[model samples]
Target: MNTPTFRNWQSVQSEVLRRIHAREWPPGELIPNEADLAIEFGCARSTVNRALRSLAESGLLDRRRKAGTRVAAQPVAKATIDIAVIRHEVEEHGAKYGYQLITRRIAVPPVSVSGTMKTRAQDKLLHVRALHLADDAAYAVEDRWINTAIVPDAAAEPFDVLSANEWLIEHAPYTHGDISFSAVQADQGDAEVLGVAPLSALFAIDRVTWDNAAAVTKVRLLFLPGYKLRTQL
Candidate 1:
């Protein structure tokens, strides 16, 4: 048997992945350092580092400072979701996109939002309500609260032309976010915005984002009936 020589980071990563899958590097087993891996694979140490870092990000490997890399004791695969402009979403569905700004104002967020975003109850947030349309029909209703303390520019911008959903995505960048999906029954507000009967079942997405320690925004999007979400792991 001969050790294989790898020329690129991807090939090195592949071999390491194979070894892990074969249990040669069992769960919780510390793997060789980059220097050793580079020598064995006939590749540069940077290549090995790149490969291991990639694995670490994907939850297949655990890398700690001053603690050598090891296979994750309990690996988890995360699904990747993209936050796209509502316009793009409708256009991709082969329909002409339209946007209507329902309301925009500065108001104190509900306790539910303030508690989740960790903002002060007395703090005012920019509340934006908008309707996204596919062709001429309603697609989704966006209810959002923007933390002006973190994203001050959002307070001044008139969202009548460009939706706050698209505006924040372009201007305010965040470090990390969380999203959840569910089926929710429409209330009077949702019924009016989506043009659906009250209590109609709709797909909903609730999202919150932060920039380091400061919360940036919290949004709830209620999509029309029969909306299907797709993601990749």
Candidate 2:
């Protein structure tokens, strides 16, 4: 018999982060409702909710009633660390910046996602993936999800020409959100995207944004190995 995939808050967080870094859900973009995420993750809605809540607490996501969730244009900096913009980070390192779009789609989110977004599971959401490069070398991968109900214009935006990251930062409006950081082993998909060996260590940043109580978007950014972040103690 085949074993069922074990779903948990950590897995959910990781998946969500993947999408964010891919720009499937761009900064300031609305994300799928929680119920959709829960269904997609094959986990309890409560579990998805818990994961989102943790991201929010970590300054990675913005959540609100009626408005739903969204990605933050400027992810809040952790008190212990200063948040750096991806493009700026690359330029500061004296590397030429590059970006590539990989995929875009609209699909029904898992129940867990819907539960977190406080929407029905049957709702469809916009998904996007992309890559960030520095001096022609893979710098990071982005995966994201967007809520059409809140940002209908997102459906027409051309992600192939301009990154969702730049688009949302210019178009979507938001008031508050959160950010977080961590380390994770590259999985098969991440390995392929980043051109690294599977199980390679990588840095991760998860963020969520909001326009008042309404959520704007959620995303995760995965950096290539050796990337360093500094903060004051």
Candidate 3:
């Protein structure tokens, strides 16, 4: 084989992820040890270890004290979302779409949000709630809080037309963020907006977006039932 080329730790990690995705190292299959991988990639053993260590941290691999490394049975794959226009998502389903602004006001964020943001108790936030519709029927309910301290311009913009999800993504460039997801029983308000039975299971996604230095926004999305989030390796 041609000499394996990797210039840095990042390159080595990318190659390892690529191999795992390709099933060269299939789930539950033991990967080559550090020394073997180092020799194969023409890198130091430490370089290979660093790459494997990172994959383990990201839930892609399982490492044991003496049993060595194996592919995780359920790897946490990364997802990429292009800040799609709501109009696009609605149209793709062959429906006319619109947005209704329920409430928009400046207030202190809720305790849950405040805890995630680690902001002072009185820090101002632009709290907004809106219903996204597909041909006059509600499709999703977006409850969002924008850190006014991070994006002061959000206060002046009119969200009566554009969706908050689409707006912030376009205006703010974020370096990184954290997202968590779970299934939750819809509450009264969510049931009303999503046209579902109270206590019905709904897909809930909570996200924190940041602009390198500070958090820009924290949002919770309550999706209608039957919403499926699918991704390939």
> Which candidate number would show the highest lDDT if scored against the true structure?
1
Per-residue CA lDDT of model 1 for 1-233, tens digit only, reads: 29979999999999999999899999999999999999999999999999999999899999988999999999786777776888998898799999999999999989999999999999999999999999899999999999998998888899998999899988897999988989999999899889999999999999999999888999999999889888865
Model 2 per-residue lDDT at 20: 73
Candidate 1 clash pair list: none
Name the regions of candidate 2 deviating beyond 4 angstroms: 1-80
The per-model lDDT (C-alpha) reads 0.92, 0.79, 0.85
User: Which runs of model 1 end up more than 4 angstroms from their true locations?
Assistant: 1-5, 18-42, 63-70, 117-124, 147-156, 170-178, 210-216
Ten contiguous residues minimizing lDDT sum, candidate 2: 1-10
TM-score of 3: 0.67
Candidate 2 or 1, higher lDDT: 1
Q: Candidates 1 and 2: which is better by TM-score?
A: 1
Per-candidate TM equals 0.74, 0.62, 0.67
List model 3 lDDT by residue over 33-105, tens digit each: 9998888888888898898998898789999989999999987776655445567888887999989998999
Q: Estimate the lDDT of model 2.
A: 0.79
Question: How do the residues 1-233 of candidate 2 rate in per-residue lDDT, one tens digit apiece?
Answer: 23234378888787777777788888888998889877766789898888888877877788888898887767775556656556777898899989898889998767765665555678788888899899999999987777767778899986886777778877888788677789999999989999999999999997767777655666778989998887552
